[model samples]
Target: MAALFSKMLTKTDIESCLCIRASPLGQLPFEEGQRVNMHVHDESGQEWIFSCSIEEDENVGRFVSVGWLEFARFKEILT
Candidate 1:
């Protein structure tokens, strides 16, 4: 026999957008032209992953661009 359950999802509280500053120099170990998988959690607690570029930089720990998943999160914060 199969069973089903009904659950109520609560509305999530909006979180303040976080402003992150990239390191002056690339301190993280990632090569230019490389990409990293970004994990993002929505207000509803749902999570997603996306790839982002590591743009050319001399710094070791530099953030080139925000991933697609993060872009969505940012958009939500704006609305």
Candidate 2:
């Protein structure tokens, strides 16, 4: 997984920590409050593993899963 930021979309998000919004990544293996490794990859082979959970939105193709780092890292990377 390549942590493609360009492909991220936020519906109703929790912007406190990292948010890996699950719309892009399909079939995540996690239960509600269950900690799992979210593997993300970018186009250039850069990857990120987010300590994530199956939030209130746990649909296979329409929910957002967040990484505790996307919030912190996204800001640093952009500016």
Candidate 3:
């Protein structure tokens, strides 16, 4: 069974994406390059759902990065 792995933020890319680290127990059930849907909650308790691809695996020492699309207006302002 595939499990939902929660991660801690290790770094942030210039594009506003997150590079997260894994758990001390072990590697996640996900495979490298596997794209999966994820959910995140903001401070106000609203849940946001999105899809992202896995960028790392067990060999990478518990670090994984998530790349996602930025909102059109946000991308324009950042550029």
Candidate 4:
């Protein structure tokens, strides 16, 4: 499967939300306001499903509205 996008995890990403850069918006298969299932997997083959909403911000552009904190906790990511 092709990757929709990828990002290097930052402090904000682990503590807050995942931001999708505006430059790749045009290449995304989904549109703004669409809800999509985000499948995330770790190196050990552990997987998690996150129901996310695609949203646009006036200042930040587009981002995946997901329960990032929950995922971060599961992955043992330190804040």
**TM values, all candidates:** 0.42, 0.45, 0.47, 0.65
Q: Which number leads on lDDT? A: 4
Instruction: Compare the candidates by TM-score and give the number of the best one.
Output: 4
What tens-digit string does per-residue lDDT give for candidate 3 at 1-79? Answer: 3445545434344356655655543666676678677676645776666565546455665555555435323335334
Steric clashes per prediction: 8, 12, 0, 0
lDDT of 1 at 18: 25
lDDT of 2 by residue, 1-79 (tens): 4434554434333345444556566666665667777666655777777666656644433444565447345545423
Q: What alpha-carbon RMSD in Å does predicted model 4 have with respect to the real structure?
A: 2.8
Ranking by TM-score: 4, 3, 2, 1
TM-score for model 3? 0.47
A best-first ranking of the candidates according to their lDDT comes to: 4, 2, 3, 1
- Write down the TM-score for model 1: 0.42
Model 4, residue 7: C-alpha shift (Å): 4.3
Better of 2 and 3 by lDDT: 2
Model 2: how far residue 11 lies from native, Å:
10
Which segments of model 1 are wrong by more than 4 Å?
Answer: 1-21, 24-26, 57-63, 69-79
Shift of residue 61 alpha carbon in model 4, Å: 2.2
Instruction: State residue 36's C-alpha deviation in candidate 1, in Å.
Output: 1.2
The alpha-carbon lDDT assigned to residue 30 of candidate 4 equals 73
lDDT tens digits by residue: candidate 4, 1-79: 6776787887777777665565674666677778788788867888878777777778877776665667778768855
Estimate, for each residue in 1-79, the C-alpha lDDT of model 1 and write its tens digit: 2322222322221232221224543364566578677676656777777665555435435444544535545566433
Between candidates 1 and 4, the one scoring higher on lDDT is 4
